[model samples]
Target: AQSVSQHNHHVILSEAASLELGCNYSYGGTVNLFWYVQYPGQHLQLLLKYFSGDPLVKGIKGFEAEFIKSKFSFNLRKPSVQWSDTAEYFCAVIYSSASKIIFGSGTRLSIRP
Candidate 1:
Protein backbone atom coordinates (compact mmCIF):
# COMPACT_ATOMS: atom_id res chain seq x y z
CA ALA A 1 0.00 0.00 0.00
CA GLN A 2 2.84 2.38 -0.68
CA SER A 3 1.59 4.90 -3.15
CA VAL A 4 1.56 8.65 -3.64
CA SER A 5 -1.03 10.76 -5.40
CA GLN A 6 -1.43 14.41 -6.43
CA HIS A 7 -4.77 16.11 -6.17
CA ASN A 8 -4.12 19.05 -8.40
CA HIS A 9 -3.38 18.07 -11.98
CA HIS A 10 -3.31 21.66 -13.28
CA VAL A 11 -3.40 25.13 -11.83
CA ILE A 12 -3.51 28.65 -13.27
CA LEU A 13 -2.54 31.85 -11.55
CA SER A 14 -2.10 35.55 -12.08
CA GLU A 15 0.92 37.80 -11.48
CA ALA A 16 0.66 37.45 -7.71
CA ALA A 17 -1.44 34.79 -6.09
CA SER A 18 -1.23 32.20 -3.43
CA LEU A 19 -0.62 28.58 -4.35
CA GLU A 20 -1.39 25.32 -2.59
CA LEU A 21 -1.15 21.87 -4.14
CA GLY A 22 -1.91 18.68 -2.33
CA CYS A 23 0.22 15.51 -2.24
CA ASN A 24 -0.70 12.38 -0.37
CA TYR A 25 1.17 9.11 0.11
CA SER A 26 0.46 5.70 1.60
CA TYR A 27 3.67 4.63 3.22
CA GLY A 28 3.94 3.19 6.71
CA GLY A 29 7.65 3.59 7.29
CA THR A 30 10.35 6.17 7.63
CA VAL A 31 10.98 7.67 4.21
CA ASN A 32 12.43 10.70 2.45
CA LEU A 33 10.25 13.27 0.70
CA PHE A 34 10.94 15.69 -2.12
CA TRP A 35 9.34 18.25 -4.37
CA TYR A 36 10.68 18.90 -7.84
CA VAL A 37 9.90 21.58 -10.38
CA GLN A 38 10.64 21.39 -14.06
CA TYR A 39 10.62 24.45 -16.25
CA PRO A 40 9.94 24.43 -19.96
CA GLY A 41 12.68 22.39 -21.64
CA GLN A 42 14.70 22.35 -18.43
CA HIS A 43 15.78 19.54 -16.18
CA LEU A 44 14.15 18.84 -12.88
CA GLN A 45 15.43 20.80 -9.89
CA LEU A 46 15.01 20.16 -6.20
CA LEU A 47 12.53 22.54 -4.79
CA LEU A 48 12.54 21.25 -1.22
CA LYS A 49 12.86 18.13 0.87
CA TYR A 50 11.94 16.58 4.23
CA PHE A 51 14.56 13.98 5.10
CA SER A 52 14.56 14.02 8.86
CA GLY A 53 14.62 16.56 11.69
CA ASP A 54 12.31 19.50 11.10
CA PRO A 55 8.81 19.01 9.81
CA LEU A 56 8.79 22.30 7.97
CA VAL A 57 11.29 22.86 5.14
CA LYS A 58 12.03 25.55 2.57
CA GLY A 59 13.73 25.57 -0.79
CA ILE A 60 14.70 27.77 -3.69
CA LYS A 61 12.28 30.20 -5.40
CA GLY A 62 10.41 31.08 -2.23
CA PHE A 63 8.77 27.68 -1.85
CA GLU A 64 8.07 25.77 1.34
CA ALA A 65 6.24 22.72 2.70
CA GLU A 66 5.16 21.12 5.94
CA PHE A 67 5.36 17.41 6.57
CA ILE A 68 2.43 15.86 8.37
CA LYS A 69 3.37 12.40 9.44
CA SER A 70 -0.08 11.43 10.62
CA LYS A 71 -1.72 12.18 7.31
CA PHE A 72 1.13 10.82 5.22
CA SER A 73 1.16 14.05 3.25
CA PHE A 74 3.70 16.68 2.22
CA ASN A 75 1.71 19.44 0.67
CA LEU A 76 3.43 22.35 -1.11
CA ARG A 77 2.54 25.97 -0.55
CA LYS A 78 3.63 29.36 -1.82
CA PRO A 79 2.43 32.84 -0.98
CA SER A 80 2.25 35.24 -3.92
CA VAL A 81 3.72 33.51 -6.95
CA GLN A 82 5.27 35.06 -10.06
CA TRP A 83 5.08 34.44 -13.78
CA SER A 84 8.39 32.67 -13.71
CA ASP A 85 6.93 30.13 -11.35
CA THR A 86 4.93 28.75 -14.20
CA ALA A 87 6.05 25.17 -14.64
CA GLU A 88 5.26 21.57 -13.88
CA TYR A 89 5.28 20.74 -10.18
CA PHE A 90 5.91 17.17 -9.15
CA CYS A 91 5.80 15.42 -5.80
CA ALA A 92 8.14 12.52 -5.35
CA VAL A 93 9.00 9.96 -2.71
CA ILE A 94 12.40 8.44 -2.01
CA TYR A 95 12.17 4.75 -1.61
CA SER A 96 14.67 1.93 -1.35
CA SER A 97 17.43 1.67 -3.96
CA ALA A 98 15.58 -1.12 -5.66
CA SER A 99 12.58 1.10 -6.24
CA LYS A 100 13.19 4.08 -8.46
CA ILE A 101 11.89 7.50 -7.59
CA ILE A 102 8.24 8.07 -8.44
CA PHE A 103 6.73 11.34 -9.61
CA GLY A 104 3.14 12.48 -9.52
CA SER A 105 1.23 12.97 -12.72
CA GLY A 106 2.29 16.63 -12.44
CA THR A 107 0.50 19.90 -11.92
CA ARG A 108 0.92 22.28 -14.83
CA LEU A 109 1.00 25.76 -13.41
CA SER A 110 0.45 28.52 -15.90
CA ILE A 111 0.93 32.11 -14.81
CA ARG A 112 -0.96 34.82 -16.65
CA PRO A 113 0.87 38.04 -17.06
Candidate 2:
Protein backbone atom coordinates (compact mmCIF):
# COMPACT_ATOMS: atom_id res chain seq x y z
CA ALA A 1 0.00 0.00 0.00
CA GLN A 2 1.02 3.58 -0.66
CA SER A 3 0.38 6.67 1.43
CA VAL A 4 1.15 10.37 1.18
CA SER A 5 1.86 13.03 3.76
CA GLN A 6 1.84 16.79 3.38
CA HIS A 7 3.73 18.74 6.00
CA ASN A 8 1.82 22.00 5.68
CA HIS A 9 -1.89 22.39 5.94
CA HIS A 10 -1.95 26.02 4.94
CA VAL A 11 0.49 28.58 3.59
CA ILE A 12 0.26 32.34 3.19
CA LEU A 13 2.54 34.41 1.03
CA SER A 14 2.80 37.80 -0.55
CA GLU A 15 2.96 38.37 -4.26
CA ALA A 16 6.41 37.62 -5.74
CA ALA A 17 7.27 35.41 -2.78
CA SER A 18 8.88 32.06 -3.26
CA LEU A 19 6.92 28.93 -2.47
CA GLU A 20 7.74 25.40 -1.45
CA LEU A 21 5.39 22.61 -0.41
CA GLY A 22 6.67 19.48 1.22
CA CYS A 23 5.31 16.06 0.31
CA ASN A 24 6.40 12.59 1.29
CA TYR A 25 5.18 9.18 0.24
CA SER A 26 5.77 5.57 1.17
CA TYR A 27 5.54 2.68 -1.21
CA GLY A 28 7.55 -0.46 -1.78
CA GLY A 29 7.24 -0.79 -5.51
CA THR A 30 7.57 1.59 -8.40
CA VAL A 31 4.95 4.31 -8.50
CA ASN A 32 4.00 7.53 -10.20
CA LEU A 33 4.13 10.81 -8.35
CA PHE A 34 2.05 13.85 -9.16
CA TRP A 35 1.15 17.30 -7.94
CA TYR A 36 -2.22 18.87 -8.59
CA VAL A 37 -3.67 22.28 -7.95
CA GLN A 38 -7.25 23.47 -7.68
CA TYR A 39 -8.13 27.12 -7.87
CA PRO A 40 -10.88 28.57 -5.69
CA GLY A 41 -13.71 27.45 -7.97
CA GLN A 42 -11.93 25.42 -10.59
CA HIS A 43 -11.33 21.74 -11.11
CA LEU A 44 -8.10 20.01 -10.14
CA GLN A 45 -5.30 20.45 -12.64
CA LEU A 46 -2.06 18.55 -12.96
CA LEU A 47 0.90 20.54 -11.73
CA LEU A 48 3.74 18.17 -12.56
CA LYS A 49 4.43 14.45 -12.64
CA TYR A 50 7.30 12.00 -12.38
CA PHE A 51 6.79 8.66 -14.09
CA SER A 52 10.26 8.14 -15.48
CA GLY A 53 13.30 9.87 -16.87
CA ASP A 54 14.37 13.00 -15.03
CA PRO A 55 13.45 13.49 -11.41
CA LEU A 56 12.83 17.19 -11.93
CA VAL A 57 9.55 17.89 -13.69
CA LYS A 58 8.07 21.27 -14.58
CA GLY A 59 4.41 22.04 -14.84
CA ILE A 60 2.17 24.89 -15.83
CA LYS A 61 2.39 28.33 -14.24
CA GLY A 62 6.12 28.08 -13.54
CA PHE A 63 5.65 25.32 -10.99
CA GLU A 64 8.15 22.50 -10.66
CA ALA A 65 8.65 19.47 -8.47
CA GLU A 66 11.52 17.12 -7.81
CA PHE A 67 11.10 13.45 -7.00
CA ILE A 68 13.61 12.03 -4.59
CA LYS A 69 13.34 8.28 -4.81
CA SER A 70 15.70 7.59 -1.94
CA LYS A 71 13.74 9.71 0.46
CA PHE A 72 10.39 8.85 -1.03
CA SER A 73 9.63 12.53 -1.33
CA PHE A 74 8.37 14.87 -4.03
CA ASN A 75 8.39 18.50 -3.05
CA LEU A 76 6.87 21.32 -5.11
CA ARG A 77 8.49 24.67 -5.69
CA LYS A 78 7.65 27.96 -7.35
CA PRO A 79 10.14 30.76 -7.82
CA SER A 80 7.54 33.52 -7.54
CA VAL A 81 3.89 33.59 -6.71
CA GLN A 82 0.93 35.72 -7.64
CA TRP A 83 -2.44 36.40 -6.05
CA SER A 84 -4.04 34.24 -8.70
CA ASP A 85 -1.96 31.32 -7.50
CA THR A 86 -3.98 30.99 -4.34
CA ALA A 87 -5.36 27.48 -4.34
CA GLU A 88 -5.27 24.00 -2.89
CA TYR A 89 -2.38 21.75 -3.75
CA PHE A 90 -2.38 17.99 -3.43
CA CYS A 91 0.26 15.33 -3.77
CA ALA A 92 -0.72 12.01 -5.27
CA VAL A 93 0.90 8.61 -5.63
CA ILE A 94 -0.23 6.03 -8.13
CA TYR A 95 0.72 2.40 -7.86
CA SER A 96 1.15 1.18 -11.37
CA SER A 97 0.53 -2.45 -10.62
CA ALA A 98 -2.63 -1.93 -8.61
CA SER A 99 -3.76 1.08 -10.58
CA LYS A 100 -4.63 2.79 -7.35
CA ILE A 101 -4.05 6.45 -6.64
CA ILE A 102 -3.61 7.82 -3.13
CA PHE A 103 -3.58 11.52 -2.31
CA GLY A 104 -2.19 13.47 0.57
CA SER A 105 -4.20 15.86 2.68
CA GLY A 106 -4.07 19.01 0.61
CA THR A 107 -2.18 22.19 1.40
CA ARG A 108 -4.09 25.39 0.88
CA LEU A 109 -2.10 28.43 -0.26
CA SER A 110 -3.27 32.04 -0.06
CA ILE A 111 -1.32 34.76 -1.81
CA ARG A 112 -1.79 38.40 -1.00
CA PRO A 113 -1.21 40.95 -3.70
The lDDT of each candidate is: 0.88, 0.93
Residue runs of model 2 more than 4 Å from their true location after superposition: none
Error of 1 at 37 (Å): 0.4
Give one digit per residue, the lDDT tens place, for model 2 in 3-61: 89999999999999999999999866888999999998899999888999999999999
Worst 10 residues of 1 by lDDT: 94-103
In order of appearance, the predictions have TM-scores of 0.92, 0.95
Give the per-residue lDDT of model 1 (tens digit) for 19-80: 98899877757778899999999999999998999999998889999899999899999998
State model 2's lDDT: 0.93
Q: What is the lDDT of residue 44 in candidate 2?
A: 90
